[model samples]
Target chain A: MTTAQLLGQDPGWLIAVKAVMVFAICVLSTLMAVWTERRVLAKMQLRTGPNRVGPAGLLQSLSDGVKLALKEDIIPAAADKVVFIIAPIIATAMCFMSFAVIPMTGVVNLFGRKTALQLTDLPVGVLYILAVTSIGVYGVVLAGWSSGSTYPLLGGLRSSAQVISYEVAMGLSLVAVFIYAGSMSTADIVGSQHQHLWNAIVLFPSFVIYVISMVGETNRAPFDLAEAEGELVGGFHTEYSSLKFALFFLAEYVNIIAVSALASTLFLGGWHALPGLGFTEQWLGGWFTLIWFFAKVNFFFFIFMWLRGSLPRLRYDQFMKFGWKVLIPVSLIWILIVASLRVLQQEGAPRSAILAFAAGVVIIVMAISSLVERNKEKVRSADLPEGEAPNFPVPSLPNVQSINVSGGK
Target chain B: MLTIQTPEAVMFWFLAPLAVISAIGMLLVKKAVHSALLLAWVMITLAIFYIAQDALFLGIVQIVVYTGAVMMLFLFILMLVGVDASDSLTETIRGLRPIAITAALGFGGLLVSLIGRATLGREAAGLVDANSEGNVQALAKLLFSTYVWPFEVVSALLITAALGAMVLAHHQRSVPRATQREQAIARFRGASLGSAAGLPNPGVFARHNAVDVPALLPDGSAAPNSISATLKARGDMLESTQFELSEVDNTVTEEK
Candidate 1:
């Protein structure tokens, strides 16, 4: 594909403008996301969050940023001074870097030059995103270690572990999309989806898995064991103050938008209009597609807010177990199914034949799982004492009161 | 956006020395955590070197794996275990340090020789051709088709190593564990043999948060709380540390 088609390799000035615009979009959207999150969460809780700052608290995040900028920046006596200072900057910067590959809209006319609305696209665009996010873990881990404090250290470790675990599942989920699209390029993935149905519909399980992984990836509520306020104090940024703390905050919201945009790109058809709303794109062209893209991204962001307001933070161990044992395996199975289907299709298998094969595979898998469950049941039943009835307290068990008295005596 | 051009020679000269300095710093740093961080910096510089050579995929992977996951693991372990608990100065094995130095020197010599013999960038000459087919796909095709067996073998080995690690780390208790109900009852009855310190004091008594009022002992003297009592009992607390310099001076003068 031509550079013009894949991405707008525009004049240097226009490209610079696009870069500035992307930065502005990320920062502005983060401000809006923070405001929207507060307002939405407040509405959910039957309270107004920050109406005093701007209209419906639109400028509340801005004020908070300003306040943070003015706060006393404390570098703890024992902290590794350099790492401590650099960590938040790394976090925020790395978070923004992933947006370089995101296809914001279709080809658009800018300053009388036609170009696709993206910063740049690599052949390994999706992998580049994964690599960047992986590197972002360093910011947290380093921040925690450099703090020279207990809570931040714990928080940082938890964040690293959480990111590593969920990232695997997230990567696996995307593999199905890559298989279906036959390319890893973000623009190509979107183009492929436009040619057919959205990957979210075709690969429903992968989409659901990606949604869950994105929440976990961003350390949002339910999966946010890393910064469980009830347990970890302020988490990795506990010792961070002033602009440094704001940077971490900025990185987090930016990351959320980036991941949401990625989810839009990968599964929701990027800047493509909704299937039923194709008329909007047809009439308005590329600009309307940007609207659809942002709308989808914001919709994901809304779900993120709803989750934070609704769900309790998951226990660290439970979160990890779910990531490793449930999500990874399920995604693995789904990828297997998708890969086989693709291979069969490539081999000129008829549609019905492919569907039948998929059904047979699913049935076999279900049967095996049920068989294992039945065997477990049998083993558990056998392990019970002969005199014990199922679901009843066994008489052979020691009496709690007597045991307590004996221990005391 | 500004049409920035990379001067590869300048970048290599800059990053290569930084990488070497950090690698040496990683070895010499007294703190394990600092050493890990230094290693991460080295890894990052190496990634930049890869990027300079147009191996963008390799560069990203280097950062993603080495600097990110591996270094994080090292730092995590260092931090969690406490930086103070670093390896002891005393070598457990006799002549181990000399042997280690000799081995390292020999390895370095071999590497230098190998590098001097081989034409540098010869292997990398194929990078442009690979880039034409898309680096990721090209690399993937080569790895899966040409080096397929070795790749599969390495993957299997990694899996085996993971399984082995899990097995080694697994602890099977010889004694049956107490039921949660039993443990709860024991705790409630104050019958559990919790620790040598007995039940911890609910109030602050010593160190940073000393209370103005002390606990009255059964014999009427003010009793030390958990932390102070533990320290005193273990003979780790110095008597002079608990009092003012004037009081200690007075006591010493009176004794003299």
Candidate 2:
């Protein structure tokens, strides 16, 4: 059935319950994510993580949340008090708002009220998430400026630039999915993925680009240059304290959850079981799709934490260059190729012919580029002084064993 | 005619006033930062109106483009330039207010007259109902097909604006910066000794000593640093001087 027929079918009470449930799920997931990150990271570094709280530190996140709530809230005497208070609220609210559009699984019956797993699915649901997350940047920027300090302002500015740069790539990467799915609705996109191979295989380049850009979009390490502790202090939330600080912290982890959920929805086939091992919706009842969805999401979450533990933060210039120069252009080109392939397929062109033409085009482009590069190198060498080589450093190779049974050199 | 009980009517009554109030606040606010923020509020309220009308694409674009990118650019500039209340009090352009008011009134009049003359309708021609296909699909169909040229031109305009900004921001420095090779050569020739000049004798300056050890002069007396000055100022220079007990026997004997 179309999304509209499914939407608004539930009574008002049901809708409210579903919304509360969604919020609860988000909070629970974030708490788990926090505890897991600490535990996993500690284990990776050969130390025990927070184990004083409820059994293996599962309730540690809750206690941390409580501590944050009870901490003394401080507003700098010189701060813009109103904006300082409003900023974190905006951040947290926007983060929660994007969760409404994500469909956790296929249709589910809750309390005899049949409804989609999502809160509400608009035809423009994906764009709604984009718009909501984009507005989240305002919270960070205002928080920085309202702090009446220098470092926070720097952090805020860095975040704005980072968001804008990565957002373009993120949006472009999604375009290929839209084209392939022939719809912008998240539900429809998932449905389309079921008809063919998952988009991860079909749109591999877009998938890769989206993964990279999502990391950049959420400001997670190694792209978390905005909040680089070695530099901008605690970044935009430097001046925030108590519950206000907790709100920013909550917003950040919630945003990570939202983006990971989105990535799963977009590229990992939403709630579909992996398209192997003869799995189907009827195999173990359709409700098992929820497990698959969360499993995929957790995989992405683990990747995020692994990256944080392994990779250093990217320098700001290198980060921006990667976004604008590499990611954007590559995605743009991939979109062009995808678009043309779709057009050719629609026009009844033979698959072999289309593939051959695409291959030939790529070869010609590469050949021409290589020829141009050779000519440029020849000109550069000819312009140099004949006998004087530039004093370029060459380090000797570290001690190595030479083979004895070799021809004379 | 719209009924008061309708959702759109209620939304209009609520949000329109909010937008107006915020817009007014933007104008009347003292701080430029506050004004910029209030302007963002207005933009957001307008976006809400668009969503209320079921123009989801328009609403999302409104927030994403104007509220997100444009106002962000505005606040970034305001904070970076650090414009305070004192800066706004000075009139940089003398006698320009009257001209601006006249121009604004003329533009408003033109807009009003155009609207008044146009045929007003509750239902516009060739328009699909809001519950039809997704507005994004409808927009894309129209944008990529019939209205493609104008859309491309608008993007080109945006590109031109970006190029113009780059050009305007480019500055050709009057004195070129020293290359790394030049700096290295200068350093090797001892022409670029840094922080070496104007430095006080290491053991003589109080701050220079790692453990706050006092500096010593050639005559084995404590050097006249800030530490010695504080001791002298307090009239305990003779009694508290560590140099007298340690190595300033000659100077102490002579002074006494």
Candidate 3:
């Protein structure tokens, strides 16, 4: 049976169980992700991270959660009380909601009933995820505004603009996938990749764009201008304390995991085993597929940590410019190419002809890009004379009289 | 009669009242942010209703386009304009309030009557066949084939609107922006040279490195400019005299 039909046959009790399981998995994975991030970042930085809580500090997140819950929760006097409290809940809830459509495993037996390990599969599953994540920004925006502080407000504004800009690129990037798969449903998209080349290989540009946009979408590392510590003082959560702050933290990590899972689903073939390990998918009544799904997710998560440890945060204007000028336009062009190719394949065009057309498109793109690069170079050179330092304002030094320490002869 | 399933019926019954209440609250809320939130709630409930009716594609689009992008832009503007900004109750135009109330009532009545007449006594046709090949595919087939011209026109109109917005927002600078070098020259030549060397560091030559301590000038007086303007305004600056050389004996004493 197809995953959708299997999902439809799930009993109420089984659905409830699956819901609880998804929630537990999300929360547990968030904890592990936090630990992994810290340990990985520390290793990159030449330090030992969190070794005192449990074995290898596996329980450190739990301890931190408790500590946060026990600490004082301060509400600034100037804050809008209701929205301030609701913001974190909105952020965290939206993060978890994105997981509802993500397929974690193939059909598996649980309590003597067959079902797919997903909460629900809407027809427009991927769109649902995008919508939920878009709403998630309200948490940060409202948190910043309701705090009634300068820094948080600035952080919130930056976050709103940043997310809106990247979201356009992100959405456009997904268009290529939808065109190739011919469905917006996550399960269908994954099933389309079975025994075939992964979308990551066939539609490589879209995958690359999706990866970059996902990082920006989740406000991570180089694109994390929203909570730039050196500038905004914790960003939108500047005034939040205790559990409220922890919720935002949890929301962030969960959002990372959610987007990673989505990347796996859309581009990495979801719960499919590796190229040579198809047999493992049949083991354990298909429950072993979960391992493959999570492995792909962890691969993406590691990239997140690698970026966080190595890359510096991008300047806000440069980031916005890249999103709008580079990512969005490239995605639009890629979508056009993919759609045309899809039409050519449907019309039974000759293979050699298709290859020639694709190659011609690539050459044109390269030529255009080189021309743009040369234009930029010309502009840069024209802005300043060769072999001369660009003039910048420098403060004049204070005049000091020379002190005659040596006595005159 | 429209056949309503148990679960969908339950959800509609539960959310319908909440949606109506929030829509009303959107109008009643004093704060712009609160009003925006209420309208967002209303939009969400409407999306849910769409999904329950098997229009999953439309429902999600409603959420993505409205609650996600449009409402977010609204909230972004509200935050920028100040969250507490509210319209004055006093009407600027004479009899404008009564006219507005009457116009709203007439509009609402017209909409209710139109919808009631259209949907009344009709069996609701479900989307089972339309969605047989999948909702997105069906929608795309119609969009590209039957409604292709209108779709293209709508897209063109959207692009035109965006271009119009850009034209409206774009402004030529009335004067050339001052470059850093020009700004520096003006700073040095236009005014006194007290700040020509740069503002003095706070807590300079002080007992501690706290920012609240004003720097000691060459003549032993506190330099007010050295301390932060915020600290000075808040009366948080420490007494500079307490840390002066005369307050403590400088005689070296050996420990026994």
Residue pairs with backbone overlap in model 1: none
Give the Å shift of residue A147 in candidate 1.
1.5
Expressed as tens digits, the lDDT of each residue in B1-256 for candidate 2 is 3333487888888888888998998888888998888898898988888777778889889998898788888888888886243345655799788888999999999999888777565354433563366577778788999999999999999999999999999999898886544545444444323312322353332223422444544333444452445555676533215433443322323365
- Top candidate on TM-score is 3
Model 1 residue B184 distance off true place after TM-score fit, in angstroms: 8.7
TM-score of each predicted structure versus truth = 0.81, 0.82, 0.86
**Which candidate, 1 or 2, would have the higher TM-score against the true structure?**
2
CA displacement after TM-score superposition, residue A227 of candidate 1 (Å) = 1.7
Residue-level lDDT of model 2, residues A1-409, one tens digit each, is 7655786787889889989998998999989999999999998888999999999989999999999899999999978889999999999999999999898877767787666678888777787888898889989988998898988989998998898888889999999998899877888898898889889899999999989988998889999998999999988989999999998998999999898999899888998888883366434445677788898899999989899889999889889989999999989988998899889989999989899978976898699789989998885565322332223222222342233332343
lDDT of 2: 0.81
Q: Supply the DockQ value of model 2.
A: 0.23
Q: Over the stretch B187-246, how does candidate 3's per-residue lDDT look in tens digits? A: 566445557667776533456557888776554467789888899899999977776566
Q: Whose DockQ is greatest here?
A: 3
For model 3, the superposed segments whose C-alpha errors exceed 4 Å read A376-409, B90-125, B174-200, B203-256
Candidate 3 DockQ, CA atoms: 0.36
Candidate 2 residue A226 Cα shift, in angstroms, is 1.4
- The native-contact fractions of the candidates, in order shown, are 0.36, 0.40, 0.49
DockQ of each: 0.20, 0.23, 0.36
Q: After aligning candidate 3 to the native by TM-score, how far in Å is the CA of A324 from where it should be?
A: 1.4
